[model samples]
Target chain A: MSQIDLQKILNQIEEIQALFVFVQRVIPYLEEIIRFVQETTPLMEEVSQSILESSKKMPTAVAELDKVSSTTESAASDMLDGIERMLDTINNSISLIDQINEFEKERLMKEKALVLKLAETLDGIEETQAANVKQALDDFYEEYLAKNCLQKLRQNIFCLQNDAYEIMNSLQIQDITTQQIMAANDLIESVQSKLVALTNRLSFLFSASFNVDSSQVKIPASMSFNTMHSIQDINNDAPGKTVETHDSEVSTNEHPNVDKIIKPAENSTCPVIVTKEKQRTNDVNIEQDHFLQE
Target chain B: MQKTILIVDDSATIRKLVRLVIESMGHHTIEASDGLEALSILTHTRLDMLITNLNMPNLDGFQLIQQVRKKYHKQNLPILILSSEEEPEIVERGFNAGANVYLYKPLIPWQLRQEMNKIFTQAKLGRD
Candidate 1:
């Protein structure tokens, strides 16, 4: 409107030139950011997928092992019952055989007198059949069928009772195995809870930093995974209850109770995320390199 | 005299097996699955001895022994540790907790019988 403002017009042109140069400088950073996201997305997803799969599979594994322990325990109990019955039956049989042997001994005394007199008369016979009959009679009389045969039967029955007891003793292995299974189940359960916690933390951090769809990696509410669960909870308490783990008693007492381990006030940017920018850090420590802050 | 002994172990099979051996010795036995249950039994039952395992949930053998020794004399309610635990430090801890004797698993029946007899005999002799 007034005289031509040549200096102002020239300044405006210079500003436009500077804006173009700044945009040109920013293009490489933008491309790098795109490339970084393109490369890192799959790796982060893979890690998340691994944690998710492990958390899901851990409980099933623990359940199968628990079934094995309980089934074997029941089987062992049944075996012990069978052995006890065998011992009791064999012991009764031994007592009965002892009584029969005593009765045979008395009868054998009378048969011996007759056998000796019969042998004296049998000595006069020369026929082969008669000699065979005489030989059988001597064997029967001398062998004392009631005492020798019946007493031998009793001894064998007693041996069987001892064998039954031996089997009963060997079944103690089940107890050792049960303890071992419980320890293993506890360790697995512990790892599962820790995995779930870690997965949740990582999913939150990744979604906040890189806009990753956390829902894919984060376990749903249905999983309801809790820490410190154990398979030894015959007490029928809650899954995360203190009554489950054997060593939990000591550990729970040692740790102070907390309402929540860590919770954010709201969804916010993680300070340590660098967003694919070049930077240098003097702090070698990972946490304080408070390193990703660029 | 017939002494009443409390058998404390998490394993039901072990409890039953130990019960049989104790009963065969002509003494009575009471059973509990853990130290907490054993402590409850000790509150109301008059027991002459306690036979416990080292490893268990809720409360372990050493803790139970310490609690028992606090309430009863070391010799009054004689504590015996029967366990598969082979660690010398754990065994020593059991003895330090007021255990009167310790026995290992897979011990022959006659050996257990003899040990039980020795416990009773020693108790009798101590009382006399």
Candidate 2:
């Protein structure tokens, strides 16, 4: 062949070899397309079955969810009811606390009122007692020991005795003031009886004139020794010693003769009795005597 | 500047009640459960006056007063003792122990207010 012809033949052989290589690459792509179709068929069937099963289960699941939601809603409503009751209880408790506060306020007010009342009562008692004490002191000075003293004393003493006996008869000893007054009255009565008896005997023996214009005659100042001694004997019959003093001796401070009247005055509230030891013995004797009688 | 008071008591209820009354008068309050606690707080905080109960757990009213006087070395620290025991000797002892005023418990709020006002005014005058 010529050189140009030989070159053309070589170029054609090169083109044919390139065509064979392209054909060999196209065979593998065709086989890959066939393999892809084979692998995708089962996978597509599995996906379709799974979707069908999921779709079928959705309604049942929705029904169960609906039931659960309704139950939860009912539970929430019950909780709301319980909360409402709790609120009511709290309200009642608050009201009760208010009532208690009101009661305490009222009680405090009453206590304040009571304290004021007690103060007023004490003031009244003090005022009344002050007036009574003043009146008693005035009466004691003006009525009993005035210048008409001895005769008045004799009359008042008798009256005091009667009044004392009456008070003792009327009152229980538990009454403190009444018991004290009654005891004083008893002492006045006993002393007054003895004095009255003595004065009458002195009047009889004196046999002297009096300056009184009235029929009730006053005894003469000059009474004899025998008559006064006899009067003393009569008085001494009671539980005390006899005093045989002249009127001169009675006036002297050395004699302290006024104690005849003053001794009873000092012991006016207390009865004259034996010593405490003698009294105890007397009490036991009385008890034994009573038992023997029984 | 507001005046501050220290109230020392074992009872929370009493402390709260006192706080309400004192704070209502535009004053500040610091609370301590007992005298020892009050002594502890006083070390760090400034207080114008003190109101304490007589009977307390850690330290009693007399002991607290003595301790405070000793620590401060000053006579101007006002103490008001409040208690139910009203014996004259107890009141005398409180005054002897450097208490400014002694008062009975379940106190009238108005009376307490007056006393606190008086003591605080005195304290102010002293500081001035």
Candidate 3:
């Protein structure tokens, strides 16, 4: 009985000694793992803090994205409206060209009639001049006997020549005015061509700007603080402020929701500012009362 | 002693009108279509006065006046500007270009005579 127990006790002791050796072998690996965990804890905490900060900013980012989307939609809508207006203006210009053509035709007709009338008047003057020459020749024989009559005839001839000269001088207005009108027409045509080129370029730029798909537009998650502030500044700026016009109806129609979007924030801020001003006044009054009491 | 005047203008009608008015005063007039043509005529002929209209092709009245001034003094050969343009700046430019007088067009014959008489009186005084 004693030998059996001793043998069993010795085997258990050997097993215990093997277990201690195994534990000793694993201790450095355990220490390395613990050190690794300790080193990674700060990184995990930083990750958790970063995730918490992102979560805190998510609403603001989403709101900013919504605002950007709205702004883009509004800008695209305005651009499309501008394009429509431009097309209408082009149509009006086309109609104006027809009007100009009609006006030119009428001007030409009037000018032609005036020319015909002028030619008739000139022919009549010529006939009258020829008759006067014939009369003068016939009267010369009768009048040449008298020196006084000859003098009167010479004076009459001079008067007739002066009248003809004056008539010739009065006709220069047409040519000068015609040249001025032609120059003005050339200037208008040049301006029109330049305007058309400008309109085409504007149309191209607007089309490119508006063609960006809103659904595909993505705001970067890791946007810098300065960039975020710039985005906020852009959001705070008055929408449709770039458009200026004499027509109030057009402006109002262009940005129907602008007042709706801005009025609530304005109203809320106005009350807050007024309340703060009142509180400041109350604080000043309280300080004055305390000083008077002292 | 009839004075010979050189008339430069783009318009034939205006030239004729000016010629008639000037010739009525016993002055002989030689016509040219533009400043360049007037320069050609002036190189060959001795002229008492030069009457030019502004805004002509090839050479303008200012260039003509400057060129004429280079050859003749204002007292020797008086340059008169006859133009339809009534702008003050244009009148000032004409005077600056060495014109003795700037007269707006649709000119009265008496006014032309008066101005010419004044220029002639001045020229005569200068000669004396």
- Model 2 Cα lDDT, one tens digit per residue, B1-76: 5778999876554565466557657799999979899999888887888888877778988888888888765467
* Chain B structural similarity (TM-score) per candidate: 0.93, 0.93, 0.94
* N/CA/C clash count, model 3: 0
Choose 2 or 3, whichever is better by lDDT.
3
Give TM-scores for every candidate, taking all chains together and pairing residue i with residue i: 0.62, 0.31, 0.42
Cα TM-score of candidate 3: 0.42
Clashes in model 3: which pairs?
Answer: none
Ten contiguous residues with the weakest lDDT in model 3 chain A: A267-276
Give, for candidate 1 chain B, the lowest lDDT window spanning 10 residues. B70-79
Ranking by TM-score: 1, 3, 2
lDDT by residue for model 1 (B12-49), tens: 77887787677657799999999999999998899888
- Model number 3 iRMSD: 22.5
What DockQ number belongs to candidate 1? 0.27
What is candidate 3's CAPRI-style docking category based on DockQ? incorrect
Candidate 2 Cα misplacement greater than 4 A, ranges: A1-294
DockQ for all models: 0.27, 0.01, 0.08
- As a whole number from 0 to 100, the lDDT of residue A223 in candidate 1 is 14
The 10-residue segment with the lowest total lDDT in model 2 chain A: A255-264
